[model samples]
Target chain A: MKTEDLKNTQDYKYGFTTNIENIRAPKGLNEETIKFISNIKKEPEWMLDWRLKAFKRLQVLKEPNWQKPKYPNINYQDLYYYSAPKSTSEKPKSLEEIDPKILETYKKLGIPLVEQKRLNGIAVDAVFDSVSVATTFKDELTKQGIIFCSISEAIQKHPELVKKYLGSVIPLSDHYFATLNSAVFTDGSFVYIPPNTKCPMELSTYFRINASETGQFERTLIIADKGSYVSYLEGCTAPMRDENQLHAANVELIALDDAEIKYSTVQNWYPGDEKGVGGIYNFVTKRGACRGKNSKISWTQVETGSAITWKYPSCILQGDNSVGEFYSIAITNNFQKADTGTKMIHLGKNTKSKIISKGISAGNADNMYRGLVDIKNKAINSRNYTQCDSLLMGNKCGAHTIPYIKNNNSTSIIEHEATTTKINEEQLYYCNQRGLDQEEAVSLIVNGFCKEVLQQLPMEFAVEAQKLVAISLEGSVG
Target chain B: MLNIKNLETIIDNKHILKGLNLNIKPGEVHAIMGPNGSGKSTLANVLSGKNGYITKGDIQFNGERLNDISTEERAQKGIFLAFQYPLEIPGVNTNIFLKTSLNAVRKAKGEKELDTLTFLKLIKEKASELGIDEKFLSRQFNVGFSGGEKKKNEILQMKLLEPTLSILDETDSGLDIDALKIVADGVNSYKNKDNAFLIITHYQRLLDYIKPDFIHVLSNGKIVKTGDANLGLQLEKTGYTSLS
Candidate 1:
């Protein structure tokens, strides 16, 4: 990396530009570019064809007409389809060879990657700018028959596994963003825990989009085999930029018979400047499939940063006795916009699902919760419950909820409830009278409001996620 | 320890507390008795720095003009109000909330933060003294607690916070005899030579447990008359009709 690049990256606490070299393709997306990404990763022929097919479908797919997020016209031809870190002159035999600026960035973000050994039983895969830079605790995970690494590496090493389940639930034509992500996604994590293996450690990935003007399109997939259980954590941050960069990622999970997967995301991407000049436009598609009997999948996300975020990580229960759950806390401040929620589809006998969503809006931001619950005719005795609540910190901000439930079976019991409210000045006064400052009281109250979802995170990530929420909404209150 | 002279307050242009005047000296406990809609709670709220109330006149806490100070500032200056209906804060452990409030007060007083062991020991001792079980400390603050339990919880907070000028805003309204006694005993134990209390109540039942030095009849948002503790017994027997 050039000296100027390193200088630019260190300016942000999360984005530390790298100096190492990388193989780069020009910035643009097309069928050939998609083919280039697949060929460069040396993926199987079937996977390459899949990418191409998804690419063609993407061109024909129309932008979604749901919800009220103002997404600008994205020029696919102008976005860089692929990016990755430059390989080292010599493989990093020690931490000394790692870029100090990048490590310093993570340290400032409170995620010091160099202290992996001290993290204790948790594996970390750190992705910088469009590529997986370093993966730790791989040896330990490998001992337990678990694959924890980048999807690109997984495609090369575990082609059959990736091919068998990629896009199985969120197919190429599932939605506009999902199709676009499927076509030109660059890199994300892939994990598979074999049958009956209780994952010995929590798995995590720290993603940083550091490069300027480069759109990031990453994809992640996790699979838990029969009777297996795994918990995964994701964290994101970006550098300050003058123009809004697009980030459209896709994540898919598959749980086999009696398996369970718990996924958590703490997103604190760089919001625009205080005046709302520029930021990242985060659009993502994440879905899971409960394929085997009694399988379960749960998603918990704390969203605090993004110029505009449009995502609804969902679950499809296609097996008997399967379960799905979504717990989320989405907060926006300073002219940001977020439209996020979840969908649960029950298609099998005795399937069950629960959704709990909390949205907080402040500083002229607009936040919305859009969720769906669908029960098919074959879903006998299915149970679905959804509760969505929104808190507006100031009169200048906006919070809205749009929930849709389609039940085809009277045997199923689906309950939906939602409410919208503003943070009462009296509550703040009460807290302050107990000796809390304005910001501290707001943080305490908001955390209290989202405790249901924050508690769902693994113990380690829960603390990190809490700090992320505090940092994201630091200046949101009076 | 606290003084308010000709204090007037309005909410949304409606005068709620009109020229209310009362004085509380250190080592004294004054009970302000009133009927419903007499602005008993409004007086407590205005004194505690709750926003959205237009105010006139002045309040002095330990000689500091308190009209411009924030609620937390007043709390730091040793004012605690036991709410009539304590707000339920779900997901916040009772101990954590107590400790945070305590530490905030201590920090404002230029004191060091208490160690976890010391804090826990203090909590255990006080919780037992107030008849609060160990389990209550681990649960969310006042969540799912019965009305009497909620009042007791407020007293528990007052005990832990140990403010110099503690205001009990109808702290006896929902309490049973036993709970009321427990709450009054907690308040009585915290009283000292340099501390004062402003206990607002509609009934005189709590006075049997915690003795008051003076009683004031509040009507139409003003203190109409002031007398000794015998006045409380007389008012309870005669009702506010005679006082009005």
Candidate 2:
């Protein structure tokens, strides 16, 4: 590596790549590309028809440019729609059958595909490039009537569930990136918790983007049946590359009567070098629908990566007395731009929602929190509370908050609170005078600022996220 | 020991400390008295390695050049400065801040850091000795603390860090008489043959509780007069106008 390139990989320790030969679809976005992707997965005719519909709609749909962060145009035709590890063509029944190099890559990324060696005992479905390479804890979960596997497998194994709730929450024609994802998304995790049962362990999926010039388009669908509960975790990272990569994923969740789904994501894709020469453009659309009375959904995310991240994991409260929550901590450093928040659409009576967003911007980065809460006239006596806080490290960075509220019901209550603070020299000096270095002081103060949202994560992930929060802002100070 | 020679400080092109010199050995508490705009706080800030100041000359602590050493390095080497206006760092719990600070200093000193239980016990005893409520230890660092409470917290930190050289910049400004006495007692009890103090104040009020070995009256960015502890009483009677 050149001396200049060494600095790019230092702070982002997940910058190495495995030399696995790839079986890739031809470059470009056309009917043939979509058919090729669908054909490779051996998806049923209905699934291919759904992709064709999305691909047809994508032609008339224009990309939304109303975001706070602007970027140059993306050449859709020059990008590879799908690239999977060649060995994954023949499905691996066990870890022994899986390619050794892919296993080593996961091991290097701190995700052991071996079920017995899972550090947190989480049942993880490891997705590499554009394929689901391995999934753990299958038999244990199967005994409990829980189905956790790759979406491709689900399409072939449980097509009825997939067809029933695949695009129910985030429709195929939602927006540009979402439609694009719906058309080309190759693989992601599929989880289904049977009625009246609680998942025994945390279900997790770790996404990795390795092949250069390949856009990772993953489609995830999770369904929690009546009287059931499940907590799902998603984590992603990519190898350091000089060319910008795109990751546009669509995640849909459905909660039935008395069921609840808690989804948490820790996204650490490789943000570009300090000069913003290259990184991942993470544009994802995730939404959950409360389809029956008393259903609940919570979204918690700690986003500290990507060159330009534009996502809003939202919830549609269509069930009476259903609850929705969003807790987010988005940290942007060194030319990274993140515009993320959530939306709560209340349609049922007495529904409730809460949002807590914390954004930290440093080293010429821009962070924005844009959220919306809409309480329809039918949603009588609904309540919503929102809090957004921004912490700035340098004068060059920017923090913005734009909250949109539409409450048509007189009896509904909505409250919004926001605060923006700069990392003042006095606070830094005080900490330093008490024996902390510049980076440690910044990290301590930032961790405190993010404590409210960080607490929403699981215990082990909270610690790891705290350390990642610190590592993300490594060069932000003097 | 702390040493200074011809220290000149210019902040934003305005000379604040013009050719100021001071020296103190262990077991000595020196008080600097001056009216407003006399660069009393500027001296303390420059000593603490605050940014945005242009300084010339030398500051030495135990035969080491502090000219280029960072603020945390100065602190790790046993030089502590209690700010005149201790910052209200929101969201940071007081107990956690104290533990992290204590551990950092301990680690830098080549010592093993204390466990949570031991550190908590030590901090609890220190807080009670100063009459601080135990509940205040868990609240956000100085977020809703009263002026006097903030001063006491500063004193509590002084006791915790136990630096070789401590500079209290206007520590008595917002303190009530009772709080002032407690703060004075904190300094008095921490006083030993191995540690020293430099107290900067606007009035001789704090000196009544913690008597100083030397009193320096500063005017127009310079220390115009230096005398024994009697100088404080004399200044209380005559005022700084006489020295000018």
Single out the weakest 10-residue window by summed lDDT for candidate 2 chain A: A1-10
Displacement of residue A440 (Cα, Å) in model 1 is 2.2
Error of 2 at B5 (Å): 1.0
TM-score of each: 0.92, 0.96
A357-412 in candidate 1: lDDT tens per residue?
99999888999999999999999999999999999887899988888889998899
Q: Each prediction's Cα RMSD?
A: 4.5, 2.4
Q: For candidate 1, what is the DockQ?
A: 0.60
| Model 2 RMSD in angstroms | 2.4
lDDT of each: 0.84, 0.93
Indicate which candidate wins on DockQ.
2
How high is the lDDT of residue A61 in model 2?
Answer: 98
lDDT of 1 by residue, B1-244 (tens): 6889899999988898889888889999999999999999999999999988889999998898899888888999899999887887767788878888889899999999897789999999998998888998899988998998888888887888889999999999877888888888898888899899999998889888888999999999889889998999999789988977
